[model samples]
Target: MRITLERSNLLKSLNHVHRVVERRNTIPILSNVLLKAEGNDLEMKATDLDLEITEKTASMVEQAGATTVPAHLLYEIVRKLADGAEVSLATATDGQTISVASGKSKFSLQCLPQEDFPDLTAGSFSHAFKLKASDLKMLIDRTQFAISTEETRYYLNGIYFHAMAEGKALKLRAVATDGHRLARAEIDAPSGCENMPGVIIPRKTVGELQKLLDDPEVIVAVEVSDAKIRFTIGSVVITSKLIDGTFPDYQRVIPANNDREMRIDCADFTKAVDRVSTVSSERGRAVKLSLAEGQLTLTVNNPDSGSATDELAVGYDSEPMDIGFNAKYLLDITGQLTGDEAVFLFADAGSPTLVRDTDSENALYVLMPMRV
Candidate 1:
């Protein structure tokens, strides 16, 4: 393929698609990106068997053709070119190499036959919907941190998405859990999502989707089937395989009857937890939280190291109680809170604690306590 495009445009499109290609691949063609030049655009595609990303950028096509080249290598070459420079890519007649020329720098990269690249065939989709970029980003940001990394329970490795009716309104909910903590976030259900099947998006796909949702003004089109999910964001398209395992009923784990309520500033609590956890041992990062009438004290003790203690005035009127939690988990939940004040509902020292932002009704968190 022969094409000429502005460096900025090519770099932007390559940045989106090259990330799908794995650093190492057993199949030779899987390591290269498929480049097709036709019409007034150059389409770039990369895949790692399970996930695929495709992006198109406006270009001046000199000859209609297609080829595959090292994804990261091409991206690096375009990235190093001077800003505003025009880049020219031409496939040699022998079909063995692709020449990249920009200003005074030129490089030739080995090419693979475009026919050898594998295609992830997305069978007919069962459901399709459009969501605002801001709403989609919010759902991902709030729950992605709790996705389990354990390989045994592969079902919990991705955020669970489904549509549910709450009171009189329908809501689209996203839930993620790592056995010790859970994060749930929801938004008003967009049209065409009420009867969609519940799907577990893989962790890597969630991360890549999050990065693509940087523009708040764009509208994202999502298509889902039983085995695969596809996201079309502007000129970029990402298709990924959904987890095959079933997600557990997360509603059973969310505490709904915790009576003791403690309202504290989210920022202050996060800082206090971070400060106290500094002295905690790496194996056990437990931080003890003691609450009384109107005071909350955070303490971390490690026999191998020193101890730390921090106190903050909170809006608590319940009986005194002490609970231990992983300091890192606490910080993760608190960091996602958007409001200044956070409410924590406690059932007991051993039971799960419920946390919610005082100003946001769309998200909630449940934390399993750690014994001190």
Candidate 2:
């Protein structure tokens, strides 16, 4: 294959698909990105078995062929070349190496046969729907942080996306949890997704897809089936395999009645936890929150590091309650709250507590209380 493309154009195309290329690969083809030159354009495709990203850039094609080359190495070479320089790529005599050229620089890089690059069979994503880019991003950003990193649970490692239509409205929902915390975010479903199966999209896939959804002006076309999902935007298509484990019924973990309610300004609450947690160096980074009669105090005590206490005025008229929580967990929940106020509904120190944005009931958060 041979193509002469502007350096900026090539680099721009490479950056889009770079994230899906795995740095460590057991298979040689998986470590390389497939580059196809023909028909007035060059296509770059990369995959890590679970995810695949394909992008194209306009190029002056002189020959029609495809080859695989190291993704990062190609990116670096194009990135370091003189700005606006024209880059020419041609196959070597043996067709086993690709010759790259720019101003005052030329190199031959080892290439793998394009026949060896595995194309993930998209496998019949028969359902196609259009979703707002902003809405999809909200679904991912709000819940991705709660996805579990522990692979043993297997099921909890991705965001659960499913369809639930209630009272004349079809709701698209995303839920994620690591057993200690959980997040649920939703958006109105576009037309024709009422029968979509619930799928657990792996965390890495969610992150990589988010990058593609960053454009607010674009709308993402979502195609899904039992085994995979594809998000298409512009000329790019990102396909990811769905995690094959069954996500536990997280609905049971969501508390129905937690009555020790407290309403506090979000900034004040997060700050109090931050200050009190300063002394909790050895106590598992735990901070205790005691609420009584509109008064809230945060306290942290560590045997080797002494203690810290900070108090804030809140809206609470319930029974006295003491709850323990991990500082990191507290921060993650508080960071997602966009408003100034956060409402905490608690049953007791041992029971799960529910949090909500005072203005909207659509988004709710449940945080499991820790034992101090």
Candidate 3:
């Protein structure tokens, strides 16, 4: 292919598509990105077998053709070119190498036949819908951190998305869990999402989708089937395979009645936990919470190191009790809360505790207690 485009335009498209290519590939063609120049645009595509990304940008086409070249190599070359500079790409007569030029810099990249690039076939989609970027971002940001990393529970390695009928309205819900903790978020379902089948989106695809949703005002078109999901955002498109397994029923773990309540300043409680955990052992970073009539004390005791304690006044009038929790897990849930005040509901020291944000009604978190 022979094409010339502004360096800024090429770099922007490369940055979006090259991330899908793996650094090491058992198949030689999987390491390259397919580039096609036709009419007034150049289309670039990259894939890692499970996920694929494509983007298109305006360019000047001298000779219409297609070829494949190392994805990271080409991205790096374009990124280093001078700003506002023009880049030219042309294939040799033997079709074995492609020449790249911009300003006084020039380089040659090995090329593979474009026909060798594999295609991820997206069959007929059962459901299609449009969601505002802001709504989609909120659902993902709240639940992504709780997704399980263990491979044995393959189903829990993704976010489960489904539409449920709540009273008179249909709500689109997202849930994620790692056995020890759970996060759930929801929003009003869009018009086209009625009766859509539940799907588990892989963690890698969720991460890429989050990055692409930087523009809150943009509308994203999503199409999904039992096996694959596709998202179209502006000039970029991402298609990925869904995890093939059954996610356990998460509702069973959420506590129905936890009467003991404690309300505290989110910022103050987070700082206290961090301070007391300094003396905790590396293997068990547990911070014990001692709740009294109107005060709370955070303490950490380690036989090898030392003991630390921090106190804070809380809005708790429940019976006195002590509970232990992992300091890191506590911080993670608090970080996602948008409200100034956090409410925690406890049944006892042995049962799960439910946490909620005073400002947000659509998101909730459940954290399991740890032995101190």
Candidate 4:
């Protein structure tokens, strides 16, 4: 393809698309980015087998053609060129090499035939809707940390997205858990989104799609079928295959009846947990919380080192009780609290503890306690 594009505009689109390219590819064509010049725009695409990302940038097209070139190599070459430099690309008649040039530097790189590239089967989609970028970003930010890294329980490796109807109103929910902790958040279901099937969005796609949702004005166009989901916004489109296995029934795991309740400032509780857990080594970062009428104390003890304790005034009036929890888990959940106060509902030291921000009733987290 013969086209001329400014360095800044080209680099912006390349940065977003290149992350989908794996460091090593079993097939050489998978490593190259397919560039096409058509209709006053240059389109760039790269993919691993599971996910594909494509972006377009305005460019001056001298002739209509297409070719595949090394993704990272071209990115690096254009990155080193002076700011505002014009980049010219050409494909020779021999069909063997592609040439790239800037003011004084030139590169002749190997090319792969465009026909060899794999085609994504979007397959008959039956659903489409529009979601606010801010709402979509919040759902991912609150739950992605709880995704499991364990390969054996492959179904737990992503956030579970589904729609539920409550009293004739539909709610969109995102849920994630790693056996030890769980995060759940909900928002108003977008109009016409009540019928989309439940899907487990893989961790890699969650990360790549997040980068595209930063703009406040961008409304994500979502289309889904039985096997795949497609996200289109502006000149970019991303397609991903959903996990076929069923997700666990997360509703049963969420506790509803816990008599004891404690209210404390979220920041103070997180800081105390961080300080007391310092003595704990890599194996167990456990901290015990002792609570009674209007008083809370956090303590941690390690045989190899000394112990530390801190006290805070809280809003608990239940009988005296003690519970042990992983310090890291508490910090992660507490950090999600955007308001000044947080509430914890507990059954006993052996049962799960439920937490949420007093100002926000839409999000809730559950943590499994550990024996100290």
Off by over 4 Å in 4: none
Q: Could you give candidate 4's per-residue lDDT for residues 75-148 as a string of tens digits?
A: 88888989989999999998789988999889999999999987675477778888888888888888888988
Clashes of 4: 0
CA displacement after TM-score superposition, residue 306 of candidate 2 (Å)? 1.3
Which regions of candidate 1 deviate over 4 angstroms? none
Each model's Cα RMSD = 0.8, 1.4, 1.1, 1.2
Cα-based TM-score, every candidate: 0.99, 0.97, 0.98, 0.97
lDDT for each candidate structure: 0.95, 0.88, 0.94, 0.89
Name the runs in model 2 displaced over 4 angstroms: none
Candidate 3 structure quality by residue, lDDT tens digits, 1-372 = 799999999999999999888899999999999999999999999999899999899999999999999999999999999999999999998899999999899999999999999998557888999999999999999999999999989999999999989999999999999998999999999988898889999999998899889999999998989999999999999999999988889898899899999999999999989888888888989999999999999999999999999999999999999999989889989989999999999999999999999999999999999987
Higher-lDDT candidate of 1 and 4:
1
lDDT of 2 by residue, 43-88 (tens): 9999998889998899999998999999999999888999979999
Q: Please identify which of the two predictions, 1 or 4, would achieve the higher TM-score against the true structure.
A: 1
Q: How many clashing residue pairs appear in each of the predictions shown?
A: 0, 0, 0, 0
Deviation in angstroms for 132 in model 3?
0.8
What is candidate 3's local distance difference test score? 0.94
